[model samples]
Target: MKNIIIAIAFFFLSYTNAQDKKIYALEFYSWVGANDNISYEMASIIFDSNLDSNDYYCNNKEYNALIRVKYSEKGVEKIFDYNAYVNILYLDNQTEIQNKNGAFYTMIIDGYAPAKLIKGNGSYNPDNFVVSGIVTKNTPRILNAYHLDDAEFLQQNIKNASVKPEYINTTDEGRAKIKKFFSSTDEMYRLLMLYIANFD
Candidate 1:
């Protein structure tokens, strides 16, 4: 009987710890056409569902919030959020500039769909291709802003469909155009920050 009582107590303790392991985005919403300038109320609209705990690879790659934990060991607070870790590393070491710059450029430069691969007959892979030269590249712009404000849900969207590496042209002129796009992205990031501040 004593052994049974101890087993029951251990089970309850284990269950409580599991519950406190922290699952985020149970209330995420999927906002469209808006940046992360969303209000807490607005954020709630996209924070409607729990993270898909079963998809560990997806969780690790893009939407890490569900798996990241904030814990304390030996009285020191430790955070597992990938973004937070990067930010701290950036601040603590100026020598890490190259790494930081690479992160920034990659984030901004690869936001758009690549030029579609048109077949000799001019047809393309409908599921994989964006219309060539139609020139509407708003998704990444909105996504970047969303990252700054409602990072949690934005991270979730990235996990769902946006984090995969994309391709652009490798020619010199194409490279120049890609550079231009990244510059525009930086400007958009600044402008969106200003816009949000003014509205707030």
Candidate 2:
């Protein structure tokens, strides 16, 4: 009886620790026609589902996007949902960051179809989705945002039933334009790109 009781206590403690883990998500958000003076909201909410870029991909590319963080604090949860750019998430903890080899993580905000770089203190798993482009209605609201590749700048809208991105037809020039479209000179930005592309 004592052994069984002790085992139950240990399991309870383990589960509680997992539920109250201290973690945060770093979300990269951006809009083509926005500036640095944009304002956002701080919200606390949860959802039933979470997905990645593979579930909804158009093409492969990167972009310089604004950041929003969703995390758990003192047993409470909070999130930031903003305009479209390319969602690349990094989910990690301070201890893991110090121990792991620059390991990052990935996750979507659940509600938005856009990809997110979810930074949480969970594990050393890396992001595999390559977000292209996402355009919004000049507002930072998530619902108004459109996942471009429905990609950032990959697929184009046409009334005609043409599958695949327009760039598929013209190889050189189209690819060049895509490169320029998602170009970033920032050192950290480039590093994040590397992490998102291939870091297992």
Candidate 3:
């Protein structure tokens, strides 16, 4: 019958659409001692298509995507009553989800409110501080390990630190020198001390 044919076509269309979606779990954290401790789940974002491009945008300048906020109240995981679009950024060409344990992406929100999701009354706000985090496909969740305020300072120090040519490239020798320098540097040590001392 004609009705049966239309139903089959609709079913395939819906299935195809669903298959094109991707989910990312976002975690928030603050620095504790020498390590970045896991704070909580900030949100679960769904992308309608493959994130293959190095850059993507919602409008002309805004990188928009759908998000579901997940949080905890009194040791219980609570899904917040908000689902909306948020502006995300991949700062530069070097930024990619495949990078290990780096602040490859950022979510721009207004100010620092530990319990608030996004900006307004559970809506998206573009006037907030930029919070950076790592992304991975191994799980639909993202862990925000570094508070941008503290992390930015440390990152700046890393950029300005003096290093030999052997420590500046992607070669094995370069990687070894980088590891050794960080292990012996007072700047990194001082940053870690301050991070633990000033954690909220």
Worst 10 residues of 2 by lDDT: 158-167
The residue-by-residue lDDT of candidate 2 on 104-133, one tens digit each, is 333232233343433333321111123222
TM-score of 1: 0.17
- The runs of at least 3 residues in candidate 2 whose Cα sits more than 4 Å from the true structure, single-residue gaps closed, are 1-23, 26-28, 33-99, 109-200
The candidate with the higher TM-score, 2 or 3, is 3
Estimate the TM-score for candidate 2. 0.17
In order, candidate lDDTs are: 0.25, 0.31, 0.35
Candidate 1 — what's its lDDT? 0.25
Which numbered prediction scores highest in lDDT against the true structure?
3
Task: State the weakest 10-residue window (summed lDDT) of model 1.
Answer: 126-135
Q: Give the per-residue lDDT digits (tens) of candidate 3, residues 1-200.
A: 99999988986775565445433322222222223232323322323334354433222233333333333444654433233444566535553444443435665532322333422244222112344455454222233422233444466542211111111223343334323222333222233233223322
Candidate 3 collision pairs:
24-140, 25-140, 25-141, 25-142, 26-142, 27-142, 27-144, 109-128, 109-129, 110-128
Top-scoring candidate (TM-score): 3
What candidate 1 gets wrong by more than 4 Å, as runs, is: 24-200
Ranking by TM-score: 3, 2, 1
Model 3 TM-score is 0.28
